[model samples]
Target: MSDVRTKYKDIIEFYKTKNIAVLMGGLSSEREVSIRSGENVYNALVNLGFKVTKMDVDANIARKLIKDNIDVAVIMLHGKYGEDGVIQGVLELLGIPYTGCDVLTSAIGMNKIITKELLKAKGIPVADYVVLDPSNPDKSFNDILSLGLPVVLKPVDEGSSVGVEIIKEEDQLKGKLRNYLRRHPNSFAEKAIIGTEITIGVIGDQKNITILPIMELRPKKEFYDYEAKYTKGMTDFVIPAEISKEQEEKVIEYTKIAFKTLNCRGVVRFDAIISKDDGLPYFLEVNTIPGMTETSDIPAMAKAAGMSFEEVVLKLLEYVKW
Candidate 1:
């Protein structure tokens, strides 16, 4: 197996003289998860003999970045300000190179509805969905029913499945949706594709992309929610998902199309479900800044590809751009 430092020796040497900051712990719902992800990356970079610092992001992040003299930023923040274009825009103004997608890509990828729309237009097979309107709860409820019962509701702009829920019965639909809407006004309901839950990790820039082995996620809970995602043993991960070769090829093709359509760069994760009904993979959503924690799918996928956690960290840093 090739090592990250050995493969990108020049990039590693160049960053040796620079101050790298692992930005995490922002004011997002996924702040705790982000902090964990940041700590792992921070330790990985340190173990790899790189000059790295751990920084908790807040409203004064811009000033903090300047104070620390951060030459490069490895974004470990997951939701809201971190995953959205806000943090990326600030980095742009400060002229600091950062990992992951650019401002526009981050913005689009953060919003599930917009991301779906863009991918759908590019001929990607996304599950049928309807945007929830807070003002008209009844209308939103009706629209959700249109997608049929047993639908999945998710916040339009959240990661780690912060406010995701599944409505199984008609009796529990309206109440669940109303309460969910109250918390996350900007949400959407999508037809649930029952099958093997799978996700694929993609790395590299637009010119050259590498798709990691597809992993099947079997969450012990109702779905891959926050608890299932962060808690150890809450989910079982299967690499090279138990799917036919043809199905795997189609998923890879769709993933590439979605990756290029969103202009995604650095390390990103595309999640989907291979329908048991039709044996077809339905691309769910794109996670631009995938978690780097011990239990994260990205690390697991990288491990299956013969890359260590430290190597994955350095690999992402290699794609840093201003």
Candidate 2:
């Protein structure tokens, strides 16, 4: 076995002939983004001389994988069935080694409410939040009021900020509810942590976790909404966020805590907010399957750590446990 610490291109030679399945595109709100991510993974793997197949996943994903005789699955799916552990569970049953966390970790990571509560119980700082089941949309409005105005309402299980909303005024709450609930019946509201929004990307195995440079997101808009996240120039990324050494250390520490407490595996990104009030980093959410496109934050963070796009892809595949 070669040292996993060796350069990526060299390590990749070991798996050149393995049948790889780049799983992307599914019945999720983020289907298009997943397709792009899968394309990145596909191109990178092919460029590295791997026997790879790009599978635009659908309802019959298992059948497709069976037909392909895939030796490993590089998951690039986002949202619902893709990110919520449904596909991970299927892959587990099929005995297919896939990227990102396992089924249980994927389930906890995708559910915003559960992730927040679990983190809070472990003394990991998280923004105060309330979960409202769609059947009882109005139930948690008052509870959410404790967070005050400018609260963020998001789907409990959705990713890529598909149905995230910022309610600055009381009048905006109803409209947000109507629109958000339509997409995701179960909604969660959290007090907006007013401060610098930083995202930390971590890579390495379960034993040794390596933190990439912290990324500070400066969106042209009020917050890092979906547009700011995907649109090329909508947000400016500050690599190795300009902050005091203490603040950067805090961000890395808390993020690593979330990674371990969540029982995460492979590479994962932890989004956090450094509150302007006390300058404390508050846990936002975990992206188990972080993006792989050129503009994706994880790759940018990896590049800051001196890893190329090909190297990042190879490292992700190398870190796969099952």
Candidate 3:
């Protein structure tokens, strides 16, 4: 993979004569994070000698693209309209090539319940979960008790752990569900896996995907929520995760399978839980358009794998095909 450095020479030459656009700052809940990522990618491309345009995404995005004559779009937006394939669909109609997964894969990967079901169908290990609708708040607590106590209640479509709650006691389940419904309107509950949390960052084509070192997330809070994830020093990231070689190998293998299962391209990240009792890793969810913030997991894993941010960004650009 060291050849990636030399391989980028051709990409650099191609970019020297092409106009690239870094799309960011959508109206999603993650708009602020998107802006940060776009700025980073924009500056990195400029430093690498590519003619770049930093476009804050708006409803008039198509007109903006035509006006700027964007040859390639480097998507830096996260969550909702950005990561959920809406923007990718628009780009497809405009006949523009962009970075990251295609529309179908992006949409599937962004939805937790759908991604879990797909993985489970492939015989991959995933925590047992039940989907819920806020309109019908008449579910029995006994039904949830079937999954056991200490369940995780979260929004089905939200990212950044916006409405996730760790219900430790049975009495608090209904209240938490009500609160989550107030925000999400449609959410679900999953049996919480009491074990180590790990994330795998993958990049490349379908046939040659590379999984970087696994990262372990130890949050000060009970779980890795939005604050613990985005805030500095709230969580400890252990590279190569302190797991057995066999366990590590299993995670890498499953990570690749999960990536392919979703037909993901460019770069993607998967989060999983390693059960302490059995040492088995269970798939949690996949992020098609993973965050690119400096402190994000993908970047951290890439650095551990000896790849610089510039190298990852440049490699991603090369992988983007219409």
Candidate 4:
């Protein structure tokens, strides 16, 4: 923590003269979570003595940014327009630097299908899945059936497991999938990898990245859904996951490859599952703007690595480049 403070001391001092906005509470399914994250970050920046303001993103975000003269944005917005490159493109055009992955990366990272395809191309182990086009229910149902029962249905662009469903039987598949497609036209069906749920946190740029201690999530629910993620006492987090050292090494290696493959920047979280059958890790998806709330995974991993929440926020701020 001391080392990070020393390294970013100049950057911190430079930001003192700038108007930094903690962008949050965007129009997304994860708006409430984003607001919580933004509040924590806003408070940290205030306690650290930086000129910061809280910005709840809306259709008028551009005008608001201009009005406030925000020079930098610590984006705490998650899902939809916030994390799927829309806001990033706006920030890029506005010429205001912000934290986290760039425009293209955010777009790719938001779509599960595209993200998995890219990771698979890079030889990163990812679960087998098929794209579901809302235009064709027949093809979508058949493709999902081919993966066998007990598959996970995921919306391509949603975060926090929003609109995600688990189909265990064939009869339940058609109705649930059709209903899901009605809501989320762009989605995919993945062969559920039943195993230990793990998440890896990475910080810094491609050249100098830090993979924090791996975490294993024991969710009280059937899987780590939205409720399990944000609800208190719903999940037990284990740091330096109970996997073998070799397994840990493989996960970390895959994490590095995925980070660079996706062109991720600042802080990101990679979710994976260690298959109960083979005990090997299969990369799932990446969170470009990971939550900074009290129960967030990134903060827990950083704490395990001996970094305070404030120091992690500073480290994230240090990597802010347009």
Candidate 5:
């Protein structure tokens, strides 16, 4: 941690005079959510006395970025082109530094199937799952049997809980899969872990990393869908989650390992399912470009860890190296 601070101090001081671009609102299903996060981050950076630009990202983003001479980019974009490493690749080509994971990690982190495979290979506990393409939805059904009923069908590369379904019975499987395919056109199914869902926030690069407090997400309905995730009062967040000390320590430890295994940088949040029976935590997925809204889980976790939202945002900015 001390080494992380020392190695990144030059970048941090350079940020004092840099023109930061807050990228958000790409042409994705999660545009609205990205806009919200972008607004929050833009406002915070402005309050922190940085020269900031709010860019509604699109195909012309590269042109705009080069034209504006963006010293660093604060990526507040979610889903599709934003979180899938497209923008990061663009930044790389344009010779600009940005926050969050690099191209490889960002692309892998957003794809649930890929992320699951990576975690499984690392001996990390993850729920059973199968990938489904538009040409072969029936194959997914076959894979679902092992995972049992009441499984979760979700878009492979989407966030903000878009195109996610919680199928409670085998009878409803076909219809749900058909409907989801009609909308998403490409999706996957995962065995829904019926346990407490928690998110752990981690910061820094490969050389050094720090784990923030754990946040327990309690949804009102069957699962933490889009509505429950974003809608006010639809969910409850318990920071420094009310888990045993051992469980908390294990969660923090696993969170760090997962972040390092993914080769993630900047700030990321890992979602996990803690089984009530044995207290074992299963790694669900990692969000490399997590939401930056004030009410977002990462921010909540940082706050619980004695860091304000502004400080967390600034801390992330400090790590942006070109």
Candidate 6:
């Protein structure tokens, strides 16, 4: 722990005049969530005595960033263009360091199909899934049905559980699937596993990775949907998830592999399902820029690991690279 503190000591001290920026509130379905996250982060930085600017980002973000002369940016945005490498690419070109993955990793991380394919290719366990195109949803039905009933449908390049649904009946599959696809343009289906849903928060980059305590999400609804996520008391979370040591170890192991394989930086949240049958952890997806909201799982896990919310925020800054 002393070594960890010493490693980040210089970075923390450098924030004295660093001209920090908290970029949030983009044009995504998760705009409101982003605003909430942004405010939380902005306040935290102020409380820590950092010179920070809070940005309700827009298409003219480049102009605003140039006007402010942002030294380093902390991304609190979610969904679509915000977390999907657009902002990251812009930051790269501007020669500014930002929290989270590089442009390549950010782009790949946003697309569910691409992320799953890469993870599976690396011998990581992922749930059975089939991609569906909005223009041609007819042919993918059979492939999806093969995965069995009660499948999970999610938008291809979205976050915060936006546009995610479950098809419990075969008859309702085609129409509902079409509507979701039409709305999202690129959505996919995965075989739903009935078991514990856990999210692991991994911090740092490469060799110095630190895995926070595992958080088990139990939504009042069937799954952790957008409503359950943002709405207060809509979900129940169990810290250090009530699993055997072996299961815990497997989750951590897979998390490390997923983080490194995706070339992630800063803090990331890896969501998974511990199968009820074989008790194996199936990698769902990775959030390259995990939320820093008041109720976000990453902060909760950090508290469990004996780190305050302010400390977690500072830790993310330590991993930023231009």
Please report the candidate that would top TM-score against the real structure: 1
TM-score order, best first, reads 1, 4, 3, 6, 2, 5
lDDT of each candidate versus the true structure: 0.90, 0.83, 0.86, 0.90, 0.83, 0.86
Q: 238 in model 2: Cα distance from truth in Å?
A: 0.5
The residue-by-residue lDDT of candidate 6 on 103-196, one tens digit each, is 8898999998899989888787888888876777777777788889889988888888888888889889977777777787777889898798
Model 3: residue 249 alpha-carbon error in angstroms = 1.5
User: Between prediction 3 and prediction 4, which has the larger lDDT?
Assistant: 4
Clashes of each: 0, 1, 0, 0, 0, 0
In angstroms, give how far residue 41 of model 6 lies from its true place: 0.8
TM-score of each: 0.97, 0.94, 0.96, 0.96, 0.93, 0.95
The Cα error of candidate 5 at residue 305, in Å, is: 1.3
lDDT tens string, model 5, 78-172? 98899989999999998889999999999999988888888778777887777776667777677776678768888888888887888888778
**In candidate 3, what are the lDDT values of residues 1-322, reduced to their tens digit?**
3465476887887778888999999989888888988888888888777899999888999999999998899999888888999999999999989999999998998889999999988888898887776666667355567788878887777788878888889778867666667677767788889899999988987888888989999999879998898888889999979888999988988887888888989988899999986888999899887888877898889899988888889977878985
Instruction: lDDT for model 6, please.
Output: 0.86
Q: Which one wins by lDDT: 2 or 3?
A: 3
Cα lDDT tens digits, model 4, 1-322, are: 4566677789777888999999999999999999999999999898788999899999999999999999999999999888999999999999999989899999999988888889999888888898998888889999998988789988888988898888999889866777788898888899999999999999989799899999999999999998998989999999889999999998988899899989899999999999999988999899999999888899999999988888889878878884
Quote the positional error of residue 217 for candidate 3 in Å. Answer: 1.0
Candidate 2 stretches with Cα past 4 Å from truth are 1-6
In model 5, the runs with Cα more than 4 Å from the true position are: 1-13
